[model samples]
Target: MGTEPDIILETRQLSKTFLGFTAVDSVDLKIQRGHIHALIGPNGAGKTTCFNLLTKFLEPSQGQIFFDGREITRDKPAEIARKGIIRSFQISAVFPQLTVLDNVRIALQRATGLSFHFWRSEASLRHLDGRAMELLAEVDLADFASQMTVNLPYGRKRALEIATTLAMEPSLMLLDEPTQGMGHEDVDRVTRLIKQVSAGRTILMVEHNMKVVSSIADRITVLARGAVLAEGDYAAVSNNPAVMEAYMGTTQGELEGIHA
Candidate 1:
């Protein structure tokens, strides 16, 4: 028997076009298992388009996507999700009115194929609480398990989203702009939380915060004008002249200051 591949997910010549304009131009990506890979680019650089193609939210105009050594370019979004690629925050995964623990419980229920059974007794669902709390603890939201999810702070809401995503038991977690808007403390908390939860899982994140990327990413792929411009560890990518010029323009000094 063959050994499992080191690449958990990969894209070959992935391209997408709209109305004769290309959004993602022949982008190829290889995401190694058990590593946090960051996809970063300046605004309008096709990062979101690339993510949509990978998740099957938008069909690729050309190229192929593979997960776990299987071609999945033709799979639907739900199909890819079931294949262990879960995109968090692309859609809100938590219910505002539900308690934090209940939010996770719902996700667990979905994963177990019991999501449609609303008629199931509350007592039967209580069994999911322990596991739900564990997921909450993984994102450092254990103490807020009983609180209404809507009442939690913004940063904590993001954490709850992570917990709910975890309940789906994803092997590859796609986090879109995990720290898009936040204060220093919240960013630090979520950054640490992401690193902590990445113990056995592979994470592919599109993050704008250089500090967050430098701190936790095992590899970085820099995009420019809808194509790959550079790929390396934080240090190598940050120091690349092409990346510095394309991503930060003339402000290369600011780009060099970002360090893990």
Candidate 2:
């Protein structure tokens, strides 16, 4: 018999209400271990809100979130991260004055909880350089290590963010719009990097790029107006009438952008 899919992340009636506005209505989501799951919806679909709720950036108005069978609905953000969940933002958050190498090194230190050594001499941190470089190389950023993070092109900066997150060795990675703005080449590079890194990890992403979603997603969940509109593989979701109608008035180019 085929082995059952191992679910690493689950949400039961998860929601978030802002004042009188329900940013995210009652929703349920399941992400299998080792799978790349995509959450897609048109604008104002509560995709981002759901992401924030799951990562503990915002508290849910109701419902529960589970990771590895542990209830983390009330866990602090840092506590959730230490439980092996790491989130990558749409805008790569890197220290402008810090060199690319130091950017990754800082992430490595954070992952290892070595932030307490802030007053230590630079030499004392040399041991971390090896692992940092290894992570940089894994994300194709080793050659740019010594350069200031602010000097990187838009795409490389995003790659650097992924490298930093990798330093945490996350079991479940949450990515918000991995390829929002980019040329064809950068998109291709990050896509390949994500696929390569998912060998042993689960990735749940909120993405607007349909091409990237269809190409890499193992399963997909579609949200519309704070609710799940559809759920399935690419072929199944791309053809759903509700999903199609929800994209009402979307230009053909926009539709084509996703169909790819």
TM-score for each candidate, following the candidate numbering: 0.95, 0.91
Clashing pairs in 2: none
Which portions of model 2 show Cα errors greater than 4 Å?
1-5, 90-92, 249-256
**Cα RMSD (angstroms) for every candidate in the order listed:** 2.4, 3.2
Cα-lDDT of candidate 1: 0.88
Put down candidate 1 lDDT per residue, 1-260, tens digits, no spaces.
Answer: 22248998988899999999999999989999999999998888899999999999999999988888889999999898898999996434678998988888888888899987878888999999999888888998899988998899889999988988888889999999887778889999999999999999999999888889989999999988899999999989887889878855645568744421
Native-vs-model 2 lDDT? 0.85
Give the distance in Å from residue 202's predicted Cα in candidate 1 to where it truly belongs.
0.2
Model 1: worst 10 consecutive residues (lDDT sum): 251-260
Scored against the true structure, residue 126 in model 2 reaches a CA lDDT of: 89
Question: What's the C-alpha lDDT at position 203 in model 2?
Answer: 95
lDDT of candidate 2 over 1-260, digit per residue (tens): 22234888889899889889988888999899999999998889999999999889899999999888878999999888888889975223688899999888778777777854678688988899999999898888989999998889988988999988888888888998888788899999999989988888899998888889878999999899999999999888877778877888454346547632
